[model samples]
Target: MKFVKDGASDIGMKLHPFTLRFVDDQAYLEEEYRSYYFSESISSIRITLVLAIFFYAVFAGLDVAVAKQYQTQLWLIRFAFVIPVLVLLLILSYRPWFRKNVQALVGIGMYLTGFGIILMIFYISKIGLYTYYAGLMLIFLIGYTFIRLRIVSATIAGWSIVLTYEIVALCFAHTPTIALINNNFFFVSANVIGMLICYFLDRTNRRDFFMRKLLEVERNKVKAANDVLEQKVQERTQQLLETNVELKKEIELRKQYEQERTKLEAQLMQLQKMETIGTLAGGIAHDFNNILTPILGYTEMALEEVEEDNTLRFDIEQINHAAVRAKDLVQ
Candidate 1:
């Protein structure tokens, strides 16, 4: 989900993704892209600058060595070719300011234009122009690939290929025989191969991103499901606690009932003992009453027979009184 703006002469060429822009903040997106752009630009600039300087020095030394032995036109052409590369290096060195602009296209255009000019000059002078052309295309591809501008990089690569083949046809058109292939042709061919490799790498990165996002989504789903399950477990645990409490209450109730039953059994035993004592007391009272009645009759008969003997009658009455007291005790 990105857009790529063509940095060359085509000002309107843009590559837009077929998706919604979820990033709501334009400033944030711009800043993020700018950081990446600058980082890559700085690295590329340093590398190209160092390489350009190195080549220039080497070419200058060779030119000096073969000044009298080789063509003057060749020396002058090689020397002129070095100037544009140096200018490109200078422009790329000021990458910080380039990021402050409205868009990255401005900086990209400046770089591409500088590189294009150098290659054009080299081609006209016939000084390994094919190699520089292929290198220029490679630079464009690498820049876009790192900065998330795939479409534009592809477009630049396509044009570079078309132009390279045309230049190749012209350069080797009337060659007598092939002794040693020109370094320019080899350089351009290698750059195309590198571009293909870069394309595959970009594709692999995109696939990896898709897979990672998918895994993240699945992980979130599992987390959500686990949360629900934990909630259910918590609810079931609460129910178990309530049930356990109820069971304890039931056990206490059973213990209370058992205690009441024991008390009732003791009370029943006491009642049975009382009933047996009442029956025994009634039987003893009846027997004592009969005996006392018999004693009273005998005493009365003795008193009547001994009317004259008052003392004997009194003694018999006392015996009947003592018998009555004994009857009461038995009752």
Candidate 2:
């Protein structure tokens, strides 16, 4: 349905004046209203049709009292024409096409119903049944309230009933002027009142339909916003999880690097101790070689001077051997 652009403060809706129907541009909304209105009012319409049929049949008793000579003929008109049509309309109310063109079809049913009464009045008024015109008011009431006819159908059916009554009463019946004027007053009053009720009731129904649709649109919008928010929350949660995993990997790498640095420091300290021990050992060996060199030279000079057969010569030979042994140890 199109919204009216008249700078209204609320949701905009516009309806035609005569019929109180949605504008032509709102065909889809009008169709939706037809379905909704039918569902809402169909049961009541059926009950009203049954009541109408019952009253029409019971009025056969009135035929007996009012016009005894033509009671049988009147019964024929009631049973044969009007009651059956009401029954047919009741049956068709469950059919599919009734929903599509509900107002037009209702107008037809109401026409047949009121026209049948006009025929009865046409005949009976000749015998001074001047009060019979009051029955047509019942048609307006039933069509408006019970049958739940929309303003368009009710107006057309009501005005047409009035027109038909006028033609018959004026042209053929030759009724008195006073009776015609009296009937016209009541007829016009009922139609006007019925039309007003029908028009307001329709306006209320259309307002309800628009509100329900607007509520649905609002609900869908909220759901869409919630979905987007949920998606963003999920994405941020995923990013945090990824960052946590990366930090754990970096921490593990730092631990491994600290262990490697400790191992390298221990190896360097051990290498420094080994080099200090080697330098101390080289210095001690050089000092012992210097002392041994002097002892070896003195022992050799004593061995050369000594004899082979004397005790002193034997002592000198032993000292030379000890000195030679000490020199080999130093080397």
Candidate 3:
């Protein structure tokens, strides 16, 4: 109902000390993100399939046009492009994770393989051309780059570029279909170059991903370890405080015991002194009583012998009084 701010607060503003928000775990957030990505990926795949179908129809129409106008044998090449692209789209749309990771690689690899096969067919048909196919390969290369599939994506792009260049050179060379084997140099060179570039890029990306994941794991581990260490320290500190409190109490008790011991010692010494005094007082009183009895008897006999007018009588009374004083001192 009420709040107090530790620092300066505006007139209408209130700060509640206990108000706090607990964030979700990192793993949970990651899982949620992955799920979102998977869902979006499914939609993208469906869109890709629709686009592929439209493009396949267009390629079919183009094949018919070329065949009607030029009597070219692009049918096999055109149909080849259509069938593979269709298969790839359907596979991606229906089974995103089908073949696990390798299948996806193969699916992407199929694009280049299909392009190469179409080129081979064109060369075989004596209607080999670069102007028509090169643009399509470039477009596919750029699209594959955007997919961000690391090695597979880079492989697709690199191969697309190299193969398109080779196809162009092959057209310029005007090599016979029978002599295609003699152009193996270009084929081998393109494959090797593309593979090397993709390999390098893939390695770099892999290292980046690995380092990021490692840092995240280490950060979480350190935080967990620190929390455990803090709890242990708190427990140990509390235990030490309790132990110190007990020690202080023990010290106080010991001090009290020592004080009581000292008091008892002093009391014992006092009692010993009193006991010695009592013994000395009793012995002196017995001797003084004996002395007084004789002195008193002598003094009384002298008083009777002297008569009422004798001068010695006063002296005898004085002696008797002096003896009485000595007896009182003894008592």
Candidate 4:
């Protein structure tokens, strides 16, 4: 339902006169629309019932008063006709299934109520009680105020009542010429005014329905957007969580590599230290071997110079043994 751009008001937008029509492009006769109308009618049941009962009582009392002064039989007939229609309205009001046909029911009820009133008016005129003709206004008032109906239904019902009354009064009631003219004028004026009011009432209701549908559409759109946004947020959150897990694993792997590198560096340093010690020991062993070689050469020379059985030769032999032991140690 597209709203015309106009000044904003309590109803959300200005309701142009062109918008007032019996046919609504935005759902008016659809199921949801009918349901809305049905609910509204159901809600008004109590009020309509009370009004019916109150009017029935008033008219019954009037019937009694007029009957005492006029024909009792005709008043009885009017009472019987009106009382049954009111009872039917009350019964139908409480029937949950009857709401679907609410417009038809109300139209029928209104027509019957008008018919009863017309009958009473006929009797009143027959008894020369012209003053009671003013009561016809009650029918129009009741149609407008108590019963909620579509413009077409109301118009049909309203005109039917007037037409029936005119025909019955003109044909059967034998109303005088001046009185007939007056009744015609009154009924016509009342129906026209009632129809106008019914038209606007229906238009206003349709506009309100249009606004509600528009709001529902907007709300659904917003909900869909929010759902999409929430889904995206969840997906992004999941992706970030997965990325965080990967980063943690990478950090742990890097830490493991660093530990392995540190251990390797410590082992490499120990290997390097062992290599340096081996080189130093080899240099010291070469120096010691050179010293032992000199000692052994001196001892051998001493042995050659001295005799085999001499004391000096024995001392040279002990020194040669010591030199040989030192050479073995150097090797």
Candidate 5:
């Protein structure tokens, strides 16, 4: 549908006014339509031609039923001209050229088939002309609606047949004025009605094509948006994963820092306790040094008095040794 805006002008035109073609600048879109119309109508075109062949061949029996002046001209018109042309059209359906020009070829085939009926009317006697006129009406119906010719092509083919019939009736065939008027009336009516049918059919088909193109565009946009969303999700997921990993590392580092803080706090507490004990020991040692001074002086005096190889001197010397060791500890 991106093409809908730039590729077509009357993206809004529901029914193409005259040409039944897109704007002149929209050639690419027109070509796309042509391809779509061709492929879609080809099978029907072939089937319609086959039906034409069958029916046209069957109508050869009319020559036997309504012979005028022993005329075999109708038989030649059916077998030699019209049936062969319809068969050629059937064969052309399989050709590459036909894909691009299907409507034109089908229109041409339709016109020639109607013209063959006109020839029949010319060759048939006045007593049996009404039957062939009805055949012409049938051709109009098939060409306009069933053969899938657009309104323009169907109109051209249909009115051209009418014009040819008028000329043949007036100049060559000697048709009475009343009969020609009657035939013209029916022919004109059929052409007008067929035009309407072709118009509606064409309009409807084009609308459907436009809707399908829009649907494709919407689907593409949705897919693109979904792709973007998916990419964003993946990116966000990766970011969260990285953030989680960093968060885990931060948590581990914080725990280690806390543990180190606790260990330092315990070591500081132990050092403070040891320092308090040392302070207490220093005060006690200072007091004890003062108390041991007199004891050391008296023990030395007693040792001096108990000298001269006496057992009393030995005991006094031991007491002096103990008092001196105590004094050194206090110092």
Candidate 6:
């Protein structure tokens, strides 16, 4: 009989908090998850960095073409700040050390990107604020798409950007109340939405990881059971082979015994025949001796009665001698 537990605990289910502060409970899965996350994020980081460079180049060119007053500052921001940070991220993505410190690297790269955008916003005129906001959205999207940060790291990076923006908007931009409220609402909403997406994405990936582990465990179990069953079958087959060999030996021995028994029976029959012949010969000799004894006795009486006649006496003696010889032969 198989015993199956019928509860969530039996299935290894645990209640996890939705807050970003809560760490994943599956400690055994950490290395495997890290490897997977690293491979995926590395490729994405390279692609996103390349795209960022291209887009920034295009924006810088457009600014030059339009003869914007802060074109030099824009170029400096793109080349010095943005390009260097992206290059650093690309370099780190290839390095083994980055895999060991993935969360930290991601958080640092995100902060650099956000800080670059904030610097651009500060330097660029108010009219170009919309363009910088668009750039910020792109950075946010890239964070969601490429970086794939853990819950704590993502929360830290995301809120830090938001706080930095709020402070910059208040102190530097010095915008009107209604516009500040609108910008805050929009940026906050965007951050919230991005956080939700990252949360769900991380959750989904982890769930799949757990599921794969479970399937692997089940497969191993089945393989072990099959191995045991195969071993038993082999053992049983070996036993049967041994039994068959023993049976063949026993059959050969039985046949040898039968041949010996037949030979012994033939010898016994020959002995019995010899015994019967000997008994018959002894009985005939006994009967012949009885007849010879009577004959000799009669011959002796006749010789005594014919004693006066010499010729008759000689004939009687001859008869007695012949009878006596016959009696000796019978004995």
Say which candidate scores most in TM-score. Answer: 4
User: Candidate 1 — which residues are off by over 4 angstroms?
Assistant: 1-191, 286-331
Model 2, poorest ten-residue lDDT window? Answer: 1-10
The 0-to-1 C-alpha lDDT of every candidate, in the order given, reads 0.52, 0.81, 0.54, 0.74, 0.83, 0.73
Tens digits of per-residue lDDT for model 3, 252-315:
9999999999999999999989888988888878987997899999998899889989888999
* C-alpha positional error of residue 205 in candidate 1 after TM-score superposition, expressed in Å: 1.9
Which tens-of-lDDT digit does each residue in 105-188 have in candidate 2? 778888888998888887798788876787798898888767888887888899999999999999988778999999999999
Q: Give the TM-score of each candidate.
A: 0.47, 0.71, 0.42, 0.75, 0.72, 0.71
User: Per lDDT, what order, best first?
Assistant: 5, 2, 4, 6, 3, 1
| Model 6 steric clash total | 0
Error in Å for residue 90 of model 2: 1.3
Query: What's every prediction's RMSD, in angstroms?
Result: 10.8, 6.6, 17.8, 5.8, 5.3, 6.8
Report the poorest 10 consecutive residues by lDDT, candidate 4. Answer: 1-10
Local accuracy of candidate 1 as per-residue lDDT tens digits, 96-170: 665454133423442444344344434333432232334454444444354333334444544554454445445
RMSD of 4: 5.8
Q: Which regions of candidate 2 are displaced past 4 Å?
A: 1-10, 24-28, 241-331
Task: Give the TM-score (vs. native) of candidate 2.
Answer: 0.71
Candidate 1, lDDT over the whole model: 0.52
Candidate number achieving the greatest lDDT relative to the actual structure: 5
Candidate 4 regions with alpha-carbon error over 4 angstroms? 1-29, 69-79, 281-331
Model 3 clashing-pair count: 0
